[model samples]
Target: MTAHQNGTISAEVSDFLLNCFVRSPSWQLWLSLPLSLLLLLAMGANTTLLITIRLEASLHEPMYYLLSIISLLDLVVCLTVIPKVLAIFWFDLKSISFFACFLQMYIMNCFLSMESGTFMIMAYDRYVAICHPLRYPSIITDQFVAKAVIFILARNGLLTVPIPILSSQLHYCRGNVIENCICANMSVSRISCNDITINRLYQFACGWTLLGSDLILIFFSYTFILRAVLRLKAQGAVAKALSTCGSHFILILFFSTILLVFVLTLVAKKKVSPDVPVLLNVLHHVVPAALNPIVYGVRTQEIKQGIQRLLKKGW
Candidate 1:
């Protein structure tokens, strides 16, 4: 009789936990439709521009190569998160299986880390261009740029792998209702029955370490760039230097702000509106995807001219 009572109690607890994690229906699906369309359009424009740049021989340069890499990363980042979000909205798959959620979280972090690394490399490129103009060609050679890209790819890829692996080992006996539309790392971590102290600690360590290093390097590079720009005799030279760094600077700022906000939202103990994080995460992903193409289109004379010519040709 005692054994039978224990089994009944366990079953009741399991049912309650499942209900807690199950996604509730809402009218948010209608809103996601238009947002998803906008995301699709932005992704298409960015990919198209990136492909055109790559195919055109004249567009081959360190800057354009970096831009191509950024575009590709942006594509992967959006593809990783937005589709699942749209699917959730459409199908109301509120409770993702544990494995699927971990995969989604892993991929999103991988691309995000890659993007951060790419921006750091871009800052170094600008530093060389502005501060070491005489040796820019030799220092940032095609071979060197390719190697740097490979290193960035490897570093981000390797570093992010452990996060998902660690997350997968955790046992989730608590409710799994992820407040956000996407499977965010912190959201997943919060649902674990086992003590998540290590997970949280690792997250903080990883977040601060990567972001701190990148930001510091970027700050130092920009400092050198500013000094070099100030030393220039001609206004035109300073203006051109500023202009060259403008798009990259804007992108870095946008990426950094979004990342910081997301991280903060994750770490905060006090619960804010769930929608706030969802909106911020969506904006964080979508805005950068949209801005990359627009920034390049507006700021790059060659790209602008190419776009204009293409439009004129109706091709």
Candidate 2:
């Protein structure tokens, strides 16, 4: 793989080594406990939420159905990256095969976008519930949830497939040591001998398009929702409306805030330590996953009641 011919090395690479926070070994040691806890929390919480939603017939509504989709995506994101991160931290298992690396990259790319799309749909769901209450039942139906799920799956799956494919096409002569924990598209492509301009440009375009569009729509939905919420003159109406959206809004903030910080750090990479972005990148995967179900369970009365029933039945 290292042999260079005509300014390019062989693309037939076997495995890539992950350099996961190696500069500060103590940092890994400190991080291992919290990271493991977060992984367990994410897995357990999402599983509980999924099972609760499934068993509770009342949760078959569009909002809960969308929540289940988010939980599923959270589970996928955690399983994709956290176990390997824990392995790297504890057992020093940093070597990932070429195929596995690219597969991981694809999942991270696709699932994250799908999660964003789901969030957008959820925002629309809330908008309808709050702004057009009378029509929400008809508008956000089983059919609507099904079509939204299909859109998320198709859009992210089709758009992000090219990222890993383009990345794999590049020749990797600059050693197989990936500086980040996971096979981040940029991290892997940076190690390639080929000009990664196309890869970088395409990734930027697609990523921003997916996330940007989702965020914009979410903003508009919430804006209309806010306007509708403010006009309510009935007692407790504003509180009820805000409470309904509180959990989703908090999750969206956590997800988008971390991502925004990561992007800003990447832009100011020259000023910031390189590890900041890497650390944020890793946290971005697990933190929201860990928080999603917990927030919903605590804030949503129905979910809390459903969980209580689930526990009682299990016991």
User: Cα RMSD to native, each candidate?
Assistant: 4.1, 1.8
Model 1 lDDT tens row, 12-75: 1221111111233453645587668768876887877886686566778887888888888888
lDDT at position 111, candidate 1: 80
How does candidate 2 fare on TM-score?
Answer: 0.96
- Cα lDDT computed for each candidate against the true fold: 0.74, 0.93
**Candidate 1 clashing pairs, residues 3+ apart or interchain:** none
| Best-performing candidate as measured by TM-score | 2
Question: Looking at candidate 2, what is the lDDT of residue 103?
Answer: 99
